[model samples]
Target: MFRKIRILLLLVVLLFVALGTWRSDSRLASWAYVTRVAVYPVAADDSPTTAQFIRELDAASFAAIENWLQREVKRYRQTQQASVQIRLGAEIKTLPPGLPNAPNTLDIMLWSLKLRWWAYRQEDGENIKPHIQIFVLFHDAKRHVGAALPHSIGMRKGKIGVIHAFASPEQTGQNAVIITHELLHLFGATDKYDFATLQPVYPQGYAEPERLPLLPQTLAEIMGGRIPVSRERAEIPKDLSVTRIGPTTAEEIGLLAP
Candidate 1:
């Protein structure tokens, strides 16, 4: 009788936990309030360029992201004056755990847990926890001239993002594009591009899919990651101005009614 009672109590606790998790996710997606996103700049390498770049950073440096998001939210007819807020946090000198190359399921799971634990100890510049946390790692452009930076990843489960970016003036807009892309991922957006080819899928990936000339698209869908120029080639948008949140992406991020 004692064993049966203990099992029943455990089951009840599990059920409540599950329900609480579901409700929290639902609330975030509901978009009733502004989602606060904290951005922490990190120096990827010990280069003078990267160090100076990090030091010059301030909250206003990320206004492009806030502007783009606001326009998108209003475009979708969301009543919230501010759908999302980006506050620059203090620079983190340490690098987060790097993603394992060719990681298996178990490896990825373990890395994710470790990353979350690391993020939990971080202080959001304001000392208060934000709805989402994005750690941006900036690498010296000259240092990585020949090699590409690591891929950025965002976890919807934890609402955290680890982004790799360049510390060059020219790449500022492009950096925001990547950051915004990962930011939406935290809000439940999925990549609409094909992994094998890195091309935006049919209609979901195209910003204006109904355009008469689908090729040479003027704008790139945010989730698609690039502007489809030809059946065989695509180009990256220089900035968020050339990128847009499509209907499908809007739906996924709760900007549109499902």
Candidate 2:
């Protein structure tokens, strides 16, 4: 009886802690503030080339990401202008490739908790605490890679995420798009693409749904796929330069006037 009681008490404590963290995260996401994001680069593949690329990663590599976010934030004139500032965090050399690749939602949550603990241990006392943490896992192109399942969780304690991408320099722009996509996920933005077809949904997924031609959209919605070539066909944007935030996405992320 005593053991059961203790277990119940522990569960209650955990529930309270989770509630508190959720409330805090909600305020941060809703408020008009500069979100400080820490980007950690990890070599997911064991290839020497991937290791070399990770070694050479610097702040300059992510310049386009920052520029893209800054431009999007400025475009929203109604709401308090919020901006995202990303800093290259320390390189994680010990993390394995399958750490965050879980089989189910429960397992994913557990992995996120483990990652949060690991990140806390990696930080030095002088480093500022990040509002969001993103781990960019670079895989070697020489090996045949499968689909990426980049994800994020917004919590006061576990505001950490993972993005799997290629290690080649040519993929840097695409990596930025993935990073921004996951970053918005950390702020309560939902995916605007259809899971089955991998195409951006109607209206919300379109950059300008009112365009006369409707097909072959010039600008791709940030939350949507890159290029809406046709009603049935859409492609990923070449870089962050052509990606934009649609009205629905802007409203969901608190960038639009509520």
Candidate 3:
């Protein structure tokens, strides 16, 4: 009789433990980060078309961002064994230009950013609310010294805008990293860009100053945070630190298991 009672007790304990684990997992998956990209149309050939440049640059930028994100998703799953899904959705069509007024442009952008966030928000949770959605905007400068601009979080609440701006399309992935860097700003991460001498900048942002490192080391290192270190004005290999998204930011988005 005692032997049978012991077996029954063991079974009950096992069931309880299983239930507890399942509940914990359910809670952890309450939030998700789904990504969708939208590209502005390519400008006409040599038309001074800001639209065309933006369209091309964003394509490259999205590719770089997606590759890095996918690798991070795999690494996070292996490390945490968490079931939370981080999905990359299909790229959507860019919105048509708004009114001619500059103020209208800002409003249009803010709304567009919200819409993108909403699309992702509807994916998992019962409530359609997301902490933030990343927006990449392309802008053409009207004058000789003009440049392209990416959407900024700062413009939203001034709380901490995570927007980025790029001058041209050829620097897509590199420009995309700026968006990644600004997004990290929301999480209180400082720029690793070394600004020591000229205007009294904080030091120690560059990780691989020599501009060379193997795969795993680059990903695991701290300096590989968001932006890559430039070597003699040239971007290092994409496979380096920029390949891995920061763990700290990933955790906040619930992409990593706690």
For each candidate, the alpha-carbon lDDT, in order, equals: 0.87, 0.77, 0.41
**lDDT of candidate 2 over 1-258, digit per residue (tens):** 999999999899789768856875776566577778888888886999899998889988887888888888778754555667788888877663344443688786676666666766766333578777788888888785566544433333566667777888998888888888877767767888898888988899888989988888988888885678987888888888889989898888766655
**Comparing 1 and 2 by lDDT, which wins?**
1
Report the lDDT tens digits of candidate 3 across residue range 5-62. 9999979966874675455334434334342323223222233555455434423445
lDDT of 1 by residue, 124-224 (tens): 44756787889999999888768988889988776789999999888999999999999988888999999999999989999999998778899999999
> In lDDT terms, how accurate is model 1?
0.87
Q: Give each model's clash number.
A: 0, 1, 7
Off by over 4 Å in 3: 1-47, 55-61, 79-135, 139-151, 154-164, 183-243
- Order of the predicted models by TM-score, top scorer first: 1, 2, 3
Best by lDDT: 1
How many Å off is the CA of 174 in candidate 1?
0.4
Q: How high is the lDDT of residue 157 in model 1?
A: 72
